[model samples]
Target: MKNQVSTIYKQAERFAEITKTAIITGNISRAKKCLALAEQLLITGSNETKIAISNVYLFSVSSFMELRHCSISNLFPKSLKAEYIKQINTSGV
Candidate 1:
């Protein structure tokens, strides 16, 4: 179980990096897809992994917003935003 969780956490981190890169390159569709994959991994991840992925997601989005001078409300897909919110609420982070 520990090894499995570790693998999931690492996969989530890679996806998070991909998401960030997609955002930086103005690839909204790719970013959304990567974010969705990360969220799916989060479902099976442990608490620590969930928190780490959440932080990465938050950081990526915030950095993108700052770089683009855009509003957070306009950044992510509605479903992604909803899933992020749900993750935060459920994870108590």
Candidate 2:
């Protein structure tokens, strides 16, 4: 169990590194992938630390907000509106 947790931690760290690189290089696609992986790992994490989850949620909300504002109004479907609503609820903003 310890080993598994360690592996997950390492994987999360790798994802964090990738996220950092993506941010530095302005590579949105890689950043999105890294952020998604980071969210998954954090979801399974038993660690008490919550910074990872918070970071993921904030980043994801920011990304989606940009998408909503930048793209055509028709691009975001009504079905996905609930997802964004949930996000806004979780973010408390």
Candidate 3:
């Protein structure tokens, strides 16, 4: 379990590095690594952690989309919205 957690942390660090490179180089593919990593972490996490992570993800996505002038629906679907609401209600996230 410790190894697994460390592996996840390392993967997240790599994603952050890629994201930084993307920002510096203006590469869309590299930029997406951060979001991909975030989704992966939440997907493999415990229910409580997923709820907490999804809260942060939702906030970041919302903020970024608004900054880019894109609609939230462009990425977040009805299912994700429902899940987020349910998690928030149950976990107080």
Candidate 4:
């Protein structure tokens, strides 16, 4: 359990870095990677730590959206936003 928690944090940190780079580069691919990694970690991580994981995921998504707004000429996918919101709500984040 402790190892799982550590792995989750490490994975989240990597995803956060990827997301930040995506924000700077305006690269959807990088953002996708971030989202993928974050989701994978959350799914594999312990239920006991889900609240914290969900909070971090929410923050990353919001950060990505803010950057998207600043750099992109068009909005990001609505479904992606919806998914994150759904996850957060379902997870009680």
Candidate topping TM-score? 1
TM-score, cand. 4: 0.50
TM-score of 3: 0.45
* Tens-place lDDT digits, model 3, residues 1-93: 654534433544444455545645766565555555556657777775465546545454544555667544534445445554565577664
Count of residue pairs whose backbone atoms collide, per candidate: 0, 0, 0, 0
Model 4 ranges with Cα > 4 A deviation: 1-14, 67-83, 86-93
Candidate 1 structure quality by residue, lDDT tens digits, 44-69: 66787666666665555555666778
The C-alpha stretches of model 2 lying farther than 4 A from their native spots are 1-11, 45-93
> Quick one: RMSD of model 1?
6.1
**Which RMSD values do the candidates have, in order?**
6.1, 7.6, 6.4, 6.2
Give TM per candidate: 0.53, 0.37, 0.45, 0.50
Candidate 4 — worst ten consecutive residues by lDDT sum? 71-80
- Candidate 2 positional error at 47, Å: 5.6
**Candidate 4 C-alpha lDDT tens digits along 63-83:** 566655653223334444555
Ranking the candidates on TM-score from highest down gives 1, 4, 3, 2
What shift in Å separates residue 27 of candidate 3 from its native position after superposition?
Answer: 2.9
Q: Which candidate do you rate higher for lDDT, 1 or 2?
A: 1
